[model samples]
Target: MIVADKKPIEEIIDEIKRHTKILILGCNECVTVCESGGKKEVEILASALRMYFTNNQQEMLIDEHTLERQCDHEYLEEIRDRIDQYDAVLSLACGVGVQFMAEKYHATPVYPGVNTCFLGATEQRGLWTERCQACGKCILASTGGICPVSRCAKRILNGPCGGSTNGKCELSKDLDCAWQLIIDRLKALGRLDDYETVYPIKDWSTDRAGGPRKVIREDVQV
Candidate 1:
């Protein structure tokens, strides 16, 4: 899932201080699971903003709403009637959701309420770690399910860099070497022989170098 964290309250306040009427929009998807921009978080932020305005002797109209998803056109259409009433909108979704919402509601300015992190997984409660970079090219088959692209500090493709020591990355002792994990998993699967095969230089054109991407599945398209 996409992981994100809330922006500083002071920064958020500064963005909307000029706007008397604002909408605090939350997403019920990724940000919800990450505890950054969910319904609960939106309510808290709305209350805080209201309190801040009240204490400062300022008049502000703050309202909260959570969409099933901000990225989907169908979900975003739910607010089509009410969106224009606000001076501005603060979206508590990933960067994608914010941009998509802004595009959908072109008349209203959309602000990001959280900082989008990366494609990651939840390790434990309150702990999320990067898992994939979405490079467009997948190589997990030869690596025994361990992603060297995202897990490796240096993003090495073939083998462990010399910086690793005792199965730990030199960047940090607590961080496991991506190559080490790959080798161990491969050994357990009796696919150690796969390691001997040299992987050619990756063609990065399929990645971000190619710019924004989209998947078009003709089979699923209506």
Candidate 2:
């Protein structure tokens, strides 16, 4: 899922200060799973903003809403008529959702309330970790399902870098050595011999660095 974190309250306040009436829009999708931008979070932020404005003696109208997904045009269309009631929109979804809202509602200014972090998964409650860099070339089959491209501190294609110590990453003791995890997983699967095969340097050309990627499906095209 796309992971993100709320921006500093001060920064968010500064962005929408010019608008007296604002909409705090949240997403019920990815951001909800990551605990960054969801219905509950939206209310918390809205209440905090109201308190801040009240303490500052600033008169502002703040309203909150959560969509099933802000990135989907169909979901955003539902708010088309209602959006005009507000002077600005503070979107609590990921960066993609913010942009989608902006494109759909060209008249209203849409500001991001969170910093898009990464495409990741929950390592544990309160602990979200990146597992895929979306490098465009998937190699999980060769690495015992461990993604060194993202999990590794250095993103080494073939490694257990000398910096790794006792199965812990050199960059941080709190981080598990990705290569070590791969080795252990491979061992459990009786595929330790797979490690003997070296993976070539990644061909980033297939990834975003090359150009915008595209997918065309003749059957899906109407």
Candidate 3:
């Protein structure tokens, strides 16, 4: 899941300072699970904005709506008629969803309400941890399911650098040493020999430096 957090109210207020008519758009997708942007959050923010405007004696019109997904054209189409009524849109979705909305509605200014953090998973109640960096290339098959690119402090392909101490990262004692964890996991599965194998240097040019990446399958294409 993609994790994000809401921007500060002060910052959000500043973005729409000049707009009297605003639409607070929320997404019932990834942001909802992370508790950053959702229907309930949209209402709370809209109410807060109204209070702020009222306190300042400014006449403001704030409307709130949550789409099943802002990134999907079908979901975004649902707001086509109503969105034009607002002077600006504040999207409470991930960065991708915000861009999608902006592209679909070219006339209105779109503002991001949440900061996209990372591709992560919920570890427990109230805790989320990053699991992938989306490097565009995956090597988990050889690494015992541990992602060194994101988990390792240095992102070493073959490592627990010399700085690692007592199964903890040198950068922070609280951080579990990624390579140590990999070794332990592989050992538990009787695959400790995998650690001795060397991995080639990552070719970043093939990953992201070339340009935007895409995957097409004739079977899946319409």
Candidate 4:
């Protein structure tokens, strides 16, 4: 999931402070799962902004709405009629949603309300950790499902670096060594031989290092 953390209220207030009319937009997707942006968050932010304006006698009009998703055109179109009602929008969705909304509505200023963190999973309540980097090349099959690119401190593909000690990462005592985990998993699966087979240098072209990338299936074209 795309994990995110809410921006400080002070920074948010600073951005929309000049606008008398504003909209607090939220998404019911990843941000919602992370408790960063959702209908509930939207209401809370809206109320806070309203209270700020009221207390200061700033004469501001703050409205809010949450879409099923902000990344899709069909869902974003739902707000087309009401888009012009606000001067600017404070988007609580991930960066993708904010950019897409700005692209769809060129007239309005779309501001990010949260800091897009990473592709990760919730380890427990109020705790999330990075899982994948979306490098465009997946080698989970050989690595026993552990991701070397993300979990590994140096993004090593071959195996644990010399820095690995006692199954923990050299970077931090709390961090587990990705290659060590891979070796252990492979051993448990009786596929320890996969460890001896060295993987070739990763193809950078498949990663974001190549540039903004896209995938298309002609068979699915509309």
Model 4 / residue 89 / CA error / Å = 0.6
Residues 85-165, model 1: lDDT tens digits:
999999999999999999988889999999999999999989999999999999999899999999998998988989989
lDDT of each: 0.95, 0.93, 0.92, 0.95
Q: Compose the digit string of candidate 4's lDDT tens values, residues 23-122.
A: 8999999999999999999999999989988999999999989999999999999999998999999999999999999999999999999999999999
Model 1, which residues run further than 4 Å from truth?
Answer: none
Per-model TM-score, in order, reads 0.98, 0.95, 0.96, 0.98
Predicted structure 4, TM vs. truth: 0.98
Candidate 4, residue 168: the lDDT equals 97
Off by over 4 Å in 4: none
Clashing pairs in 2: none
Candidate 1 accuracy as TM-score: 0.98
| Pairs in steric clash, model 4 | none
Indicate the TM-score of model 3: 0.96
Worst 10 residues of 1 by lDDT: 205-214
